[model samples]
Target: MLLKPITPCLWYDGQAKEAADYYVSIFPNSKITSVQKFNDSHKAVTDQDTGSVLTVAFELNGQPFVGLNGGPHFKFNEAVSFTIQCKDQAEIDYYWDKLGEGGDESKQRCGWLSDRFGVSWQVVPAALVELMVSSDPEKAKKTTAAMLQMKKFDIAALKAAGDS
Candidate 1:
């Protein structure tokens, strides 16, 4: 029977296990669940190693995610980012603080920050999204306009812009 839903799979260039361990260590309620190694039954031409891990499955912040030690055929980019809807600035700050380590920061409007991992994160407050896209179209437009110019989310600035 299915118990927990499957999580996202992340590909790292032969660093899948290391990355999974790092992520689990940073997030509470996290652990490595299973691991599989490479064997001669594999299909890759270069991956003939006797005992290389093919995949590392783990949980971070109670969410399951798998990491593959795939060869350096691909890399992560800013095209896709994990969005964290925060109830308050404290929660946003907490995640920002943790993930921003060893990463660059690009503060974006309305609570968005790009962590050092070159991963863009929308650290948006739930209320802020609602307010920015409220029933008032003009207000929302104004708020969006102000947001377009910012890197770090500024609720007060957006509100003021919306009002005017």
Candidate 2:
């Protein structure tokens, strides 16, 4: 079967445009492709005109995404997450700093963070994936253990865990 990516849609009460623009600004190769407004067929639902957009199509790092000014029917939780694979700890730190804008901090294992957008991301090291999923279960468990202790994963730490 042919496969295509379906972008993740983020629902906001009235800040879709602002959030989309903010995300595009932070990530490379990102842009807002279209801003769709409701047609006359639909009626306004909130103080902000409902017929107007709150729905936009955008891309970040070649991945497509949508933002909608949806009412408070749904919200983000730690259950769902996005992963950013980093080349090294420095890259992880850079993303940690930039993405954490306006957001809170939780130093969990595997370099996971929640951004100002209320989006949870697991900033994993590329090498870590390789190590944690390696054929050797002992090594994998060690790496996993190391990841559990860090909010921003340290490659060296994971390696040490494997060695231990």
Candidate 3:
């Protein structure tokens, strides 16, 4: 049996290229592979301007993704989100700050943020999983409590909570 790669497609209202560029800039080992423009056939179906961005193929940290300029028929919501696992506090901070810039402040909570493009992202520390599943139930509970109160996760604070 052969395994095929799965790529997540993000639909945007004519901002696919812009969003893809932004994502490529922020993530390491990322780049825009291609930009497809709408043709006469697409214009007939989608009513989008011919020659406009139809899709953008890109990779982030080696993960393949496609950004489609599919118009305003759909929208991004909290139900779906991309999670960035960070190795440490510094990494968490870097991703949080970069991805959260120009984002909706009201949507920021519990390490989740909605970017300017309305895409939700979870910038979480890798240690968060271990803390949440600690063998000591009390430590896990305290760590979870601390985590719930923070918009941006603080690894040190979570560690202290677990220790306490």
Worst ten-residue run, lDDT, model 2? 41-50
lDDT of 3: 0.91
**Which prediction has the highest lDDT against the true structure?**
3
Rank list by lDDT: 3, 2, 1
lDDT of 2: 0.76
**Measured by C-alpha RMSD in angstroms, how accurate is candidate 2?**
3.5
Ranking by TM-score: 3, 2, 1
**Which candidate number has the best TM-score?**
3
lDDT of 2 by residue, 11-108 (tens): 77677888888888877898888898766555644555646775888888878888888777777677888888888888888787788767767534
Clashes of each: 10, 3, 0
Runs of candidate 1 exceeding 4 Å displacement = 1-6, 40-44, 104-118
lDDT of 1: 0.71
Against the unseen true structure, what C-alpha lDDT does each candidate score? 0.71, 0.76, 0.91
lDDT of 1 by residue, 33-125 (tens): 999888877855555485888889888766777878778888766667777666776776677667667665544444566554345666666
Residues 1-164, model 3: lDDT tens digits:
11127788999999999999999999999999888899998755888888999999998998889999988999999999999999999999999999999999999999999999999999998877898888899999999999999999999999999999
TM-score for candidate 1: 0.75
Error of 3 at 39 (Å): 1.1
